[model samples]
Target: MLNTNETRIKYFFILGFPGILPEYYGPVSALLFLFYLAITMGNIFVLVFVKCERSLQKQTYYIFCHLALTDLLFGTVTLPKAISKYWFNDSIISFYSCLVQMFFVHLIGAAHSFILMVMALDRCIAICIPLRYNSLFSNKTVSVLCGISWLVPTMFMVAIMYEILRVPFCNSNIIVQCYCDHMSISNLGCDHVREVKIVALVLAMISLLLPLGFIILSFFVIIAVVLRISSIRGCIKTLSTCTPQLIITCLYYLPRCFYYLANFVGYSFSVPVQIVIVMLYSHIPAAVNPLIYCMQTKDIKEKLKKKLFSWKIDSTTKPMQDKTWQ
Candidate 1:
């Protein structure tokens, strides 16, 4: 039984790796880089393809474009630094660097969460009141939603930053995990993380569970509507459109749901499992989104064709064809 007087283990001792297995720094670092290369290149290609392709400039997919951008930002904020620490086993981030890292991480994370919410809302409005979907999710409305999705997360991250800055450092300054995570930074604080945690819980409810609840409700409604459609073709088309979004949402949220559940429920998963879980939380959102949007979208494909064709040159070393932006 932990004593009431025992301060909740102020300042976690980040004793170096437990070293259960051999450290393959070389292979791990290489693998991490390869993953980044794939994610970064793929996402960049998707975004540029979408933007350059004029046919893609529509409401729902426009929402998806911004979603892709935010996901890119999310991956950018966490993985590079994490990859740095993982291969190096070096935990010497300056306090200021840690603070910035912490801020951007939460910023991107909150943005990703909220953007998913926006997507659900867009789908909901489109399905629930198709008559007014154009009016409801108009250029202005979507623009506002996208702007808020980026801005609110910035504010939320600032709050977490304040909480983290209040901590009193103890013995060791090393972070045990791949990067400077939320809990790891929170652990740096001394007593009185109570208020911060409550705020955290509330923000999380807004960010994750609240949106998830809305999405679930909206999906059920969407499903009910599809069932009532007189034509099977209508039903199938609706299902097809929803499928990619559903898959991407589940992939992005399920791991995070499990990671938190594991933390709250008390489990004995090994460090490697935990590490993989964390990596999934950071990477999969970025990775799967482009794959989902691009494969499902024909307009984007055409734009890619146009852009690639104009940008490619003849083998005879002639100049490239002129490109026209739609």
Candidate 2:
């Protein structure tokens, strides 16, 4: 416990998966290390491909690149510290460092939510208002949309962080989850935090529900528009574009909604179970998004195949070149 006048603490101990036995730390750390590596590499591939490939320079792929950026930042912000906690026993994070982590975690997440809504809006326009999509969502317009996606969430998150900082945290300096977040950290403050909690809940709903509602409505419009098309092939082609977005959306939101509901229901879930649920919603989406959105595309798959074949040929010829030199 901190002294009464000591409103702030310097470090907060992050306890990741309290249920893990001492002997299991090695395996868990190794697994998380691999997980982080795969997610970062995959998102990087998507980001580079989008930027380098001429064919993928449209607004749609631009949104994909931003999504990749968000996923990469999110994974970097949340996972590395948790891995260190288990692997290197570096669980103590500075107070400001934890706050920075919390900011980016929520910022990237809210940005992704807004981006998904923008993607859905793009799809709706492409399908429902096909004639105007190119006009309505020009490069400048897309840039503005992307700017809004990043900015609005940041403003909200900054406000949340400010409120959290204003409250003195004289209580335990231990965070119950894998990362520092508004809810987890704010809950630890020794002050009367009922109003803080309520405000946090409202901010959460605004950050999540507003964009979510727009996404749902946009998809409904998209499906309705797609259903009206007379050509079966056209309908199939249009629906194919939406499949990845739908999958990514479900992967991102469903588990999150369930986790929130579980908490609200006051179910006595173990700490490990709660952390596992959080990991499922947050980590899995970032890890799998590149595969779903990029690799699943026929163009990207063909490009990858050609690259692999060329690499194999180079490797095969390298040995011959060495023999000749000998």
Candidate 3:
């Protein structure tokens, strides 16, 4: 319980979720551990698939690769500690460590937003204006966009972190969410937090809303182009390509929308409910994004099927080979 009056705050005790019965902690911990496991394995599959299969190395998948990487990074940064908090009751984090965690949590989130926006643009180019897809989305161009996705968020979050660092936290050290975040950390600071709030609002706009707006605009144009295609097959094909992106977008954005709007509208949710919603949006994408791509994308699915079939063949033939050798 370091006070602001003292030299400086030393640590933060992260209260993973504010409310749960003693009986529920084990179940909750088990569930979150499972979530972390799923997220890790799913994202790894996508990453390995992208790396191993040359056919999956298209510009669009370059964006998907970044998205998968971001999700993996996001989950890795934010989840294990939270899982530890729930399972082992190791909730204390040093102040600076908390800051670092906050940085990556937001950094990766903003990067994911930008990546999704880039994917929308790729989808639009591929589906709406097929001729220019090659010209507009070359590997070099996608690489540049990927760099921007990482760089812009880093810049924005750095600014936000600077502002956060300036806030004096002399109050109680419990963060109400499952992890340390900008809002939770800043709220614990002593003094007027108007500046932090302003910065957060701006960051949210730049990182979340701006990308979402661009995605919406892209979707509208894509729908218009898709409508013009006379053949049902062409329309279905175009729509199918866009569907996974849309699903991923919705998972990432919709919960954020509800949370942000609830706060803005002064709607009060129970702490447990809020925590549940926040945790779902924060980590579920890590699991869902890769699963969606693996199942929905034709190329990735084909590659995965071939790999699985090869594994099955190897497993069945391994015993026969051993017997023959004997």
Per-candidate local distance difference test: 0.70, 0.85, 0.87
Model 1 RMSD, rounded to 1 decimal: 5.7
lDDT of 2 by residue, 44-136 (tens): 999998778887788888888889899999989999999999898888999999999998998899899988888888878888888998999
- Pick out the ten consecutive residues of candidate 2 with the lowest summed lDDT: 1-10
- The model with the greatest TM-score is 3
Model 1, 151-240: lDDT tens digits are 987888778777756655543454656666676656555555677777777776687787788789889998898899999998998777
TM-score of structure candidate 1: 0.83
Clashing pairs in 2: none
**For all the candidates, what are their Cα RMSDs to the real structure?**
5.7, 2.5, 1.8
User: C-alpha displacement of 240 in model 3, angstroms?
Assistant: 1.1
Weakest ten-residue segment in model 1 by summed lDDT: 1-10
lDDT of 3 by residue, 1-326 (tens): 43455426888888777667767878888998898899889888888889888888899788888998998898899888888887887889998999999999989999999989999999989987788889988989999998999999999888888888788777788788888898898888786578888988788788888999999999999999889999999889879988888999999999889888998899988888888888888887788888899888888888889989999999999999999999
* lDDT pick, better of 1 and 2: 2
Give TM-scores for every candidate, taking all chains together and pairing residue i with residue i: 0.83, 0.91, 0.94
User: Once superposed on the true structure, which residue ranges of model 2 sit more than 4 Å away at CA?
Assistant: 1-5, 265-268, 309-326
Of 1 and 3, the candidate ahead on lDDT is 3
Tell me the deviation in Å of residue 242 in model 2.
Answer: 0.9
Model 3 pairs in collision: 4-170
Residue 252's lDDT within candidate 2 is: 84
Residue 262 Cα positional deviation in candidate 1, in Å, after optimal superposition: 3.9
Model 3: ten consecutive residues of lowest lDDT = 1-10
